[model samples]
Target chain A: MTSTTAPVDASTTNRTVRLASRPTGEPSAENFRIADEPLPTPGDGEVLLRTIYLSLDPYMRGRMSDAESYAAPVPVDGVMEGGTVCEVVESRSEALEPGDIVLAYGGWQTYVVAPANQVRRLDPTRAPISTAVGVLGMPGFTAYAGLLEIGKPQAGETVVVAAASGPVGSAVGQIAMVKGARAVGIAGGPEKCAHVKDELGFDAVIDHRDPEFKAKLKEATPDGIDVYFENVGGKVFDAVLPRMNTYGRIPLCGLVSQYNLTRLPDGPNRVPSVMQRILTKSLTVRGFIQNEFVKAHYKQFQADMAQWIADGAVRYREDVVEGLDNAPEAFLGMLRGTNFGKLVIQVGADPTQSA
Target chain B: MTSTTAPVDASTTNRTVRLASRPTGEPSAENFRIADEPLPTPGDGEVLLRTIYLSLDPYMRGRMSDAESYAAPVPVDGVMEGGTVCEVVESRSEALEPGDIVLAYGGWQTYVVAPANQVRRLDPTRAPISTAVGVLGMPGFTAYAGLLEIGKPQAGETVVVAAASGPVGSAVGQIAMVKGARAVGIAGGPEKCAHVKDELGFDAVIDHRDPEFKAKLKEATPDGIDVYFENVGGKVFDAVLPRMNTYGRIPLCGLVSQYNLTRLPDGPNRVPSVMQRILTKSLTVRGFIQNEFVKAHYKQFQADMAQWIADGAVRYREDVVEGLDNAPEAFLGMLRGTNFGKLVIQVGADPTQSA
Candidate 1:
């Protein structure tokens, strides 16, 4: 609802990353195409936006496939859907005007024109403008909602999150600390693991890449895991299962590790083991999308998250890739755990911050 | 807590069925041995009990093995543990004297001695004395607590329960019906399925033995399952998972189908599919033992169940296998879904009913 306006730029060219093909397993650079577009004029109740930052996430991998899921797959030759921080370059509504910075689902695009009511106006004074699409946006909301609402970590209880250096997992671990619980973060290698432990202030950090990963996990969680914030599901999940204590809660948020799996691994079926463990241990495994709790918890999440950031109780890191041309490669890299922090693309320069 | 008693009968010898050896998979008659011993005498605050009805449940099978579980494995040469409806033969405490019918953990024995405070005195006038260990005791409590507390079947929602002819499953279906939800039962044979749908008044019933079971399930659950009270986990669970709706709740109380298996079945593991469906559908899968809810729900369960039985809003059937000597065969049969209803061993004469 905060705004500052300057003269409108009447002429601007837009660039978009479109899905070029569907992926069978992991996506590749060939699956995306960059296209140039003319400036879109605002219609009634609409605002024309110049995208500043575009978020690249593992979920985008799901949208590229025509598999059965909660959401529909992105069609080949369609703009890849994503969250972006944008500035209003033109306005045709009473609600918004030129130069206003706002958060919009502008996809992997340099410009977007949307209904004024559809975009959330953001103030640069609250935090950095790009945080609107990073920590203070969907990923931050995901961790806040899933952890507190479902994981329900108690004082001194151990809460484990994989992909711990990323946006959602990092926020999850820090928020677990904020809530009086012990946070154990699991990341890919030594660097990310070190960042999770030292910089993020997680009580313990384990590298999934270590040959002694399982044994190290046992050493780290002496009392066993009480809450596992599941972001990656594969070998990491296999390691976490046996370490779960009785009545442990699993908030299944994402299955990043399994998203690229073309077929299930061969086995003496472990599904029965899962059910058996669930039964004998009296555990709770709940899967959820952040929006499920949004109506009930969003306002409170915004207030609490803003306060946590303001008080230094919470901090975040960003892996901001440059140029709209690099989005596809960055996104593919993110799914493979190449990004160290919240991955975002600087689609255009931020008007509120000096270059 | 209520009681009535008469003079003790002092001449009876005790007969017990003990585990002769643990079986690799399905238990056979060779795995059990019957022994004769002198009746146990009450000491101080203890009472001598004559087990009238011995409940045979799927959970009992877990106790027969050395495998790890929530409770300790019943030791080799140990009497098979079970819920029993007993008649107090002698009491040294102020709680009761002789001839008071009660519920006790008397195992597969003809007579047991226990602390008077441990046995719960039953009111035969309110419901049959045998009902204490059948529909009105642990099995009944399992259904009420797991279904309502965990599954949380909303009015008009569809609830599917397998092994639907057994005590736990039947009670689950009836309780789902009581909560105004549509109950779909899955049993092994046409006869059991008929009993489930016709006598039990379940909205629908499918025979898992049918070659067309998967399609039949699809037809039966037109709205998809909102709550799956998982009693038999194997192909039954395989069929149920895909049919689960968004936000579906699964109260996993038992995995009777896999309890006897020594090793897991060969597979391209379906655990990934389980996790995937959970994420995509936003489901809640919780496993619990009924006793966990006893302290909170027992008082209300007793009152509500008694009222339901009195009003004919609920009904139950008993599959009574007479005498302690036949306990092994009846038990092995019960595990294979041979029993039509609540399976009980008639270990002693019921004073309130003629033999």
Candidate 2:
């Protein structure tokens, strides 16, 4: 398609969501305030871009709290930081043209002025542009690096992951299967469970919501679990503990279930029991963020994941909301396990669509 | 000192303490009953040995209970299993000779008949015979393999270990220092704490019994803990958890404090918080039994430890009880943190004493 490069001045209006207050338990609509602001211009070595897709992930919950964490908390009255796929509209640098699509950390805003070098260009010919914020980006890399580096699944072993239909867990299960291991996925309901087993090609899928979930897991894996990719720790983790085999590896990636908990759960502390299992089973329970392995594994992941995607061995699903105004509601529902896939907001549409 | 081979008779007398009953909490004198029986003769390819020193460790506490564990429960009314340094009394195989000191899994009994291949012969001239049960055997190997393999301490990093005067913890701290990492030792009393810091050359030491234990730990480690060699689980662990640095490695070796608990301790369930820290800090909490690394790292450990001992780089202390009748009480004391150093029962006098 032929495209004309026009120097369109920065728009007068910019939509943004400000962090109204720090969340005490579950974040609400009141925690975010939608406002309009004057658009920002591209400065030296910078580009003015409009967000096409804004990604919502579980790690954002940690950033909302004022508690000590690996990363600093999102301050009150600031836009929530997130990954976004954007189209470069105005560039002050010689490196980029007006229509080039790139991956950006633009936060929850319709328009942002970011340094050109800070954004990575994404080719429209390879995969969908929105995927740069979903499957082929942070979430996909998280699963790949954490599983191979920490989980280290061997062939014929059973690999189990909770939140099986989400971006990271789905990638983890698929990658485990590709490595010749049996992937057993645990999800919240039958639909996600079915998607995990049928679409994602997991060997087995169990619904954690079922009353007989533990028994089902036991029946599902005749050989006990060798690797458990921990994402949603709570009752699901409790159920998975006794089922882990000797020398089993648990790559603890997240604890989405406990993110909203304001107080410690009621008594009969299971810490001793957990320690007992660790000693008896000789288990390796490692917690890791993907950034630790990015230096060593990122290049390999790009090559392998791209090949897997092209060969039809790996598949992904995305759940998209229509507007920037809907982001807060979409994110709140995501924390409640209402979103079916990698949730993304369609802040704007592709300019190439009209060509 | 000329050695004479003792004739093995099928009807030789043997005395053993059987498990009278499983203890509810702390083991009492009534929990053990001494019995007299005829000694077992060596079969083909077997050797008979008289126990010299039986090693007492926290793991034996698990064997006393009927609960499930990594290994099968020691059968009720059976002689308690343990590691021992013994002298061969009768040899049916050419591999072993009478008066040869060897390391054996001979249990807590006066005499044992087992295959010659099951025991490793030790050189009495090279080192003290009891060293096989303390600084150069299973406990020492446990410390070395777990710390180096799982903990992987880098230079300038801080390593914290509890029960610092015990064989494993003492070795771990010294090894961390050898790797150029700061070693912080945690023990139950002032005397043991002093021994860990003053004698063993640990960078810092904290008494877990002190009312300001946590405050003292904070003062000791200006930089957060990088490796926590977890040997004692309880309030000591609770204090250490928050102080762990990002990407911390925890080698979960033994939980001496929780071994005697009949039920879970009363408190708010801390598993969620543990999982949260695991996720946020990117910690690696690995539980291991030393036998797992025997094939991979044992040979190197023996060479390195032997040289360290010979050069006085690694020193060990032993608390010996004089008779077999005192073993149960000594072992009970070891579990309760009453016994210092490596607890060993001297069932008989060393024949080399005459030399």
Pairs that clash in candidate 2: none
Off by over 4 Å in 2: A1-10, A352-355, B1-11
Clashing pairs in 1: none
Chain B TM, cand. 2: 0.95
Residue range B1-355, candidate 1, lDDT tens digits: 0111232343577777888888889988888887767888889999999888998988888888888799987888888898899988888989997888889998998889999889899888888888888778988999999998999999999999988888888889988998999999999888998899889999999999899999999999999999999988999999999999999999999999999888888988888899999999999999899889999999999999988888777889999999777888888998887878888888878898956
Poorest lDDT segment (10 consecutive residues) of candidate 2 chain B: B1-10
Worst 10 residues of 2 chain A by lDDT: A1-10
The digit string of per-residue lDDT tens for model 2 on B190-264 reads 899889988999999999889999999999989999999999898999999999999899999899888878889
TM agreement with the true structure for every prediction: 0.96, 0.96
The best candidate in terms of lDDT: 1
Instruction: Tell me the lDDT of candidate 2.
Output: 0.88
Chain B superposition TM-score per model: 0.95, 0.95
- Candidate 1: deviation at residue B84, Å? 0.7
